[model samples]
Target: MDKLISEFDRALRTVFAPAASVRPHPDAQIDEPAMDIADKRHAAGLMRVNHCGEVCAQALYQGQALTARDPAAREALRSAAHEEVEHLAWTERRLQELGSHKSVLNPLWYAGSLAIGVTAGLVGDRWNLGFLAETERQVSAHLDAHLSKLPQADEKSRAIVRQMHADETAHAETAVALGAAPLPLPVRLAMRSMSKVMTGLSYRL
Candidate 1:
């Protein structure tokens, strides 16, 4: 019952509350450049996708934390979740600065990610860590793509993406250091396929 409530609270906070980061946002100091309509639209689209990604991250980490049987693993998952909340808040603030709104399907994304996280957790701690590492690896790759695609003049967005990429890379490395087992090739491919679908749809929606 406690876990259920905790999960419910996390969902509510993620879906409705204004996120507050523990650390300062990377783009907080950078002034928003006067972007051309095309650049602004493209930047906004990418940031929206990023914001949605953080939402899914929150769900995934929270779900995994709930099911983690080992105290050390649970703490690790919760710590990662805390960092993801900061990322979410930063992206959300960036979206508003860009004159954009979040993805309309955010709740659906959260639900789906939470289900996946729970399933991975049920398989055991090593698999749970493996899933997280893979997720972060894929996110880092996409952030790289977004960095390449961002407008040259959009320094603020670029700063945020760079910091996020670094953080995700570190997270993946941490998972590996914690003895994460490598997932099977088929599972990895399926994860990538799901990510592709989410990214393609989230770019516009």
Candidate 2:
């Protein structure tokens, strides 16, 4: 019951509260570039998508940690989730700097991702880790895409994205080392499709 209560509290904080990061902001040293209105809007859109991604990541890790059977697996999920919270803080700050709001659909994204994470956890640890590994892999690729799309002058956003990419890659490698099985091609494809839908809608709404 205590664990359940804690999870509920975490969900509320993740979706509703402003996030706090332990690490220094990635762009703390970078000067805010004098971007024109269009570039500012574009950068904000991209950062919004990234922010929503971190929100979903929080949900996924929490849900997995809730059901993961192995103690080590649970710890792994929890550790990754902690880092994801930092990502959340970084992206949220970036969004504010760009003068934009987070996605209105963040709650929906979190709920759906939580369900998926729980399902993955119930499938056993190997597959559970596989799911996490795949998630990070896709997220790394997505960050790379954002790095390309972000305005060159917007080094603040780029710096954050680069740090996130490196962190995600490390998370994926950790899962693999912990005995993650490879997901089937069909499952991978389905995951990619869902990601596409989320990104497409999140970019504008």
Off by over 4 Å in 1: none
lDDT (Cα, tens digit) per residue for candidate 2, span 1-205: 9988998899999998999999999999999999999999999999999999999999999888888999988999999999999999999999999999999999999999999999999999999999999999999999999999999999999999999999999999999999999999999999999999999999998
Predicted model with the maximum TM-score: 2
User: Per-residue lDDT of 3-116 in model 1, one digit per residue for the tens?
Assistant: 788779989899778899989899878888988989998998999899899999999988887787777777778888888889889899888888888898899999999998
lDDT score of residue 98 within candidate 2: 90
Number of clashes in model 2?
0
Q: List the residue pairs that clash in candidate 1.
A: none
The residue pairs that clash in candidate 2, if any, are none
Error of 2 at 197 (Å): 0.7
Q: Write down the lDDT of every candidate, Cα atoms only.
A: 0.89, 0.95
Model 2 residue 118 CA deviation (Å) reads 0.5
Whole-model lDDT, model 1: 0.89
lDDT of 1 at 87: 89
TM-score of each: 0.97, 0.99
Candidate 2 lands at a TM-score of 0.99
